[model samples]
Target: MTAIAVTIAGTDPTAGAGIQADLKTFSALGVYGATVMTALVAQNTTGVQGVHDVPAEFVRAQMRSVFTDLDVDAVKIGMLSRPETIRAVADGLAEFAARNIVLDPVMVAQSGDPLITPEAVATLRDTLLPMAMVITPNLPEAARLLDADPAGDEHAMLEQGRRLLDLGPEAVVIKGGHGTGAESVDLLVTQDEVVRLAAERIATRNTHGTGCTLSSAIAAGLATGAPLASAVRAAKDYLTAALAAADDLRIGHGQGPVHHFHALWPNLPGEKR
Candidate 1:
């Protein structure tokens, strides 16, 4: 049986983030990738120049087309630029009763561009968050979602994760990679338990699209029948290795991208300079 995962995100022409990165990550992890673009971004490793969000009706149409034709084992959502689009997506998921929905509440980009608006955040919390199977948010994003300052420590991260759980997702993964530290710790909190995944932070500039890749990988695992915790664990391991492997590949003049195919063709992991 083949596993399929859908990514609802913006399009990055550079292929470093958004739907392109999600698709590449899904393929590398052996899952069929499908996508519906919410916006078109003119961006690169360095920064984003502009964004053009797709109309809400068109977004709904694309989602309907996909769900109508495909089994859609799982869905990963990212970069929804407008509140209407977010509401539509939430409604569509409810209409289709799609399972294994992974929501990556993408508030800002690595380059510090605003991918989501203030109004859209409310929509995510009130509309989409309830329907998500799991929601993945980094420290900054979690803070924004919770409308509270992340205490800049593990304790705060845990609290914020728990707060997000109140919004209705089955689980919340508070990514700690964005925190200032030598170790990256991601806290996964569910109704049952809190699972922590920690890894030594790799000093690499090639970390673009990491969030998209990780969420999509988790979606892939879920689509293939892996339990939520197990799926997140697998995704963390894969992403850690991918980061280590591509720490040196210079894809662009600015911060480069993690080599998604590094596992397919193993070479030296990370740059020793």
Candidate 2:
């Protein structure tokens, strides 16, 4: 049976982040992709100029339509721009009882534009956190979610990951890509263990959609029946390779996107190693 993964996120016409990135990740990982746009972002690799959130009722309707018709195996959520949107999503997930929900707490964009409202942060923590199988937040987003100082060292990042785990997600992945270091270290904190995934930081500006891609890839892996740890491990591996093979071809003048299809192509698949 073909696995289906749904992404509840904003629409990025630039295709770097949000629903476009999630769908691309799902497709690359061989999972059928579905989406519910929570907001529409008018920006690209450069920066975000405007954001218009979708009506909460319409968001619910979209979820209903997808859950009613498809056998969704997993879900990836990102860019819920409003508290009402977050509540509506939580309601839909409860109504449908979707499994393997991966939440990417997206607060800021790669261009440093704020993607989420300050008030919506509480709603996300209280409403959506409990429903997530795993929540992926970058260092800055994690700080925002926890209301902690954003100037954290590696130790602080791990502490924040542990704190986020208490908010109800079965696991938390604190992405260290935003940290100031030569190596990017993502910490996965569960109730029982903490696993660290460290990789050499790729010095490329083409990392616009990394978080969205990672979360969606993890969702696809979960939908394919991989365990939580295994899914995260695979996701980290995939994103690392994707970053290393980033299309420095410069699609846009600003921060470009990762080479999502680097693993595909006639002979390039083996080159991923």
What lDDT score belongs to each candidate, Candidate 1 first? 0.89, 0.90
Clash pairs, model 2 backbone: none
lDDT value, residue 233 of candidate 2 = 94
- Candidate 2 regions off by >4 Å? 266-273
- Which pairs clash in the backbone of model 1? none
Provide TM-scores for the models. 0.96, 0.95
Regions of model 1 farther than 4 Å from truth: 266-273
RMSD for each model, in Å, please? 2.2, 2.8
> What is the C-alpha local distance difference test score of candidate 2?
0.90
lDDT of 1 at 95: 85
Per-residue error for 28 in candidate 2, Å, reads 0.7
lDDT per residue, candidate 2, 193-261, as tens digits? 999899999988899999999999999999999999999999999999889978634567788888777
